[model samples]
Target chain A: MLRKADTSATWAIAFSTVFFFIGGLLTTVAPPMIDKTWSKPFENNDPSKGPTGKLVNYTPQQLKGRAIYVREGCWYCHTQQTRTLLSDTIRSGWKGVRSPVSTPDEFVYDYPHMFGTKRTGPDLSRVGGKYDTQWHRTHFRNPRDLVQGSIMPPFPWIVEDKEEFESLVAYIQTLGRAKNWRPDNDYEK
Target chain B: MPEQTSGRVALGAGGTVPAIEHCDTTAKWFMISSVSYFFIVGIIALTIAAKFCWPSLLGSVQYLTYGRLRPLHVNGMLFGWLLPADMALTFFIVPRLCAVKLYSEKLGVATAVLWNIIVLGAVVTLPLGMNQGLEYAELPMGLDILVVIAWLMFSYNIFATIFARKYEAMYVSLWYIMGTLVWTAFVYLTGNFAVLFATGTNQANLNWMYVHNAVGLIFTPVGLAIAYYYIPKSSNTPIYSHRLSMIGFWALAFVYVWTGAHHMIHGPISQWLQTISIAFSVMLLIPVWAAVYNFFATMKGQWHQLRESVPLKFLMSGVVFYLLTCFQGPMHSLRSVNAIVSKTDWIPGHAHMALLGAFSFFAIAGIYFTLPRLFQRKLFSEVLANWSYWFLMIGGLGFFVTLWLGGFWQGWQWNNPAIPFIDTVKALQPIWLVRFFSGVLMFAGIVSFVYNVMATILGQARDEAQTV
Candidate 1:
């Protein structure tokens, strides 16, 4: 069959387009079409709503802080996704435990998803309520000062601007606490 | 004298050789631009590497902060360096192989200019905290439009030339080039434009689709085209088998699209998506190995040429690295291994082996092989070329090893609740230091390459002008 007349160009173009269509339909296009139970946030106490209830949305400040996160290209280093795998779960203590896997509903509000490719630092999936706002400010000023060997770049620029700094703090502290599964604490202070 | 006499004899038998209707001016300009970008982007990468070791180094400058500089380094490498090198090769090879001059030198020059403009926009805007936030498609909409315009001009010029070709039979390299051009345009539009309307996980899924395809369709096909043209021509042999080349080409095209989803494995995306991606990713090894074997078989008796020719040395070494990337790709795409290395440095190290080791080597070789011919003179210094090759080879290997092992060390430690996160970062300090120094060596190697290109092109041009 390979020894047939030269149709290399035609075959290459046709197969490439077809494979792209199939892959797109199955992976990219199909995921959003199928409704899953885990696509939304839920609490154990809410029996009527079930575990797939509509999760609370981010505050305006948190949204602004997310904008700051994207602006600074924080996603390049810090990934927000915690997989169901043991290694991922154990490493990233989501909700103060080694078990809460991230679901689609957690990212329903994410316009441009921050499921970063690299984890140069610890996962930020459940980083909200883990550290105080003061710690974030100091770390952003000089990461090395707080964590001796931290590779995170200093965001002194973000620190100088009070609005950007507070917004970013608001954003970081809300990472894992968006769902009402736990008593959501206001980390604004 | 005997070699010169034999060359004339070969020329006599090598048929019509149609007036050498080449776009030498545009081709030389593209090569020079690509080398300069290599120098600039190499320095930015070195800066990024240093920040990983000394977090406070240049931390005060908001523009040079790790986040901004990271994108700068990425865009610079992708658009500034690699893309130009690939386009330059297309400019040179397409015309010669088709026995026709480029359709429009003016359009080609315009494309090159606009290409750099789009990259310049990314460099300026990203550092200023003005960005669109998409990983590979980080440029703002205005600049993205400019990129599309530049690519359109380039595609039209090449296709017009090919359509009017005086040659009868289309070579395999031409087929590859045409496929790359069309697929690149399709993926770029779909990934960047169509993605703007997509929301949530759908956007993430499509983003990976674009990200992975950019490497698979654009760089892979174009790099292979350069290899298909140069390797056999240098070895004084036909391709090992035209039949195998077709199989490799179609297989690569079919398998790569399905494999993009592997990047999203265990993330917010569905389980079925991961399954399809991993299955196809493992299957991807077939095409990759087919090409690898074809290259080695083509060079069966000509292995000794590696010591003599710098271009062949780069091309052959690229094939070896290509093999490693494919092997590692399949292994890591599995759910188990990916779970361990997904967010760790292992993936980055592996990505570099493909980007810098495999494809970048091919680009450098294409430049070296074509530059002298474009200028009608031999290279100025083979010694400098050899030195550049070794430094990059050693430095790239060293860089990959440190990151690969350090990634595993960090991942394994992170899995233990007893090990604090900061402690993992501390333990990896020595590896980071090695990575930094090795990066410096790679930077030096690029500097040597740029200097050699300048000396050869300029020095030879001066000699010819004086002779005339």
Candidate 2:
């Protein structure tokens, strides 16, 4: 039995294909300035001057942990950027200092922001002063011990070696440089 | 049994059979049992949501907290309700399409049973607040094992059937079904990696990847496969363009995975990654629009079928929603757009529009179209089917509007530093009321559909029954 291609189907295919290409093309071309405008002003916070300065640069092993994270798609989940705003700060327990008002210029040297989407896990944008290397290592080995309701899978393999564990901790420590220490007002209080 | 005998003869002659002999009565029974469980679970979720919209109706319990129960509601619909139906349809459709019997009925039934256990385990565990806290991936580790085993079993059965098929040119539906099964296996495994579980960072990326792919690679493809087959089969015409189907399929597969990051717009991830995600997400318009065009074009002159056939009603309505969902999805992915709507009801509105509106509707239509032919019975009542369609249609439309508008309102209000969150939620009270009412209508529609399906299967057949 011979079958003829329907005209309607042909046209549908042509139209949709054209639309897909156009949509893709439009994204590459800078969106109109008005379309890219933000409602709020960006804030600036520098982490290098904060307590996070206590741990700058990575050991080779920590670099490996970062490599593992990228290779295994860990960035798919944890975001390293925090908005300098109240709502996110409140939810993340970093309210007041780490608001959405924070601007990208604060991290002028940083390439591809690791700010993640979805809150399946807590934001890691301000990891510098939150926990110690041991906490980071133990949590990486088994998050359930730290948070009973954590849905995060265990990464025992990453922490199996002490050197690797230190490196991984070092990498995580580099995540949020700007808000590693509480503001002076809070400390004075 | 003349119809059965003719079907067998068609199979023997290698002629195109209107239907094939459905082996595995046990699998069918398991599917029915799962569907029943899903219906009950669906109603319970709807009731909970109803109470949430009107909190006075039910006092608070930790187990039924909005945070806990919302995930339950979503999981039940996706896993308990839709997954089983899609699996059953796969078992039925693949064999007929391939001119072969399922490789093993026992394996099929085992998969169904395990799937039910896994979903039930989630229902039991989640209410206790023992969840993984991941949206859609909320099932705890123990239950995740069961789901993984069930998926492996399904993958094996589907592959075995494909290998055993007699057909030379595999139909488009077969490609989609096979793709869904194979890709899901990889997608699920990667998304739920044992290594990344502790870092917590992996969870977000994995969850977004899994959730997005679950829609794009798994549910969307299966739903579209059914549409591709049923639309042409019902119209008694070959598809308009085989080449387009191939192109659309490849484009969709390539683009969808990269697009998941779009959900993370303005996220702390690298600017390059976000830009890439947005670009690919916008690019998705090609494959998606291609599908929409193909579907609409196929129905160009056969528009009358939409009026007469309940299956067509579901299918066409589903196609329309698919277009709407894709359009809205890319729009939401835009960074400026995400700044307003992220973490709000807007996301759920998109989800419902795609999952419930597009995929679920198409899945039901496929089941409705295939059930009678497989069972050798007339549909119990056209009237009940029509009523169910209208109920769901009206209810779904109402849900889309109210949620979309409510989401925008919430986004606008939350974005304003001057406006407080509590007052924004308060402002949404009326819209939430509409959502609850619409949900109730949808619940009624689901019950009606279940009733129609069950009665048709068990009820006495008419003397002059027409072939489905």
- lDDT tens per residue, model 2, A1-189: 011212122232333344334433333222222222221112324555434322234457656656555433344345555553355555344444543323333333222234444332445666555577778777877665876545455566557777666666766666555434556523110
Task: State the displacement of the C-alpha of residue A150, model 1, in Å, after optimal TM-score superposition.
Answer: 1.6
Q: Residue-wise lDDT of candidate 2 within B164-201, one digit each (tens)?
A: 56554567677677667766765666555531432232
Label model 2 with its docking quality class: incorrect
The C-alpha interface RMSD of every prediction is: 4.2, 12.1
Q: Over the stretch B1-468, how does candidate 1's per-residue lDDT look in tens digits?
A: 011112121212545545764756667767888889899889999988998888878877878888888888888898889989989989999998767788889988888888778877887898887766778888788998998898889888887876666554567787778778878987898788877886556677778888988998888889899999989876677789776887887788678877777887888778877888899999989888888889999999989989888899899999999999889989898988887777888877898998999999999998888878888776767788888999899999999988999998777886676787889888988988999999988987898888889888787444432433
Q: Chain A: TM-score in each candidate?
A: 0.79, 0.60
TM-score: model 2 vs. ground truth:
0.74
Worst 10 residues of 1 chain A by lDDT: A1-10
- By TM-score, how accurate is candidate 1? 0.92
Off by over 4 Å in 2: A1-183, A187-189, B1-20, B24-27, B194-202, B460-468
lDDT of 2 at A14: 38
Q: Candidate 1: lDDT of B336? A: 82
Evaluate candidate 1 by giving its C-alpha RMSD to the native, one decimal: 5.4
Q: DockQ winner among the candidates?
A: 1
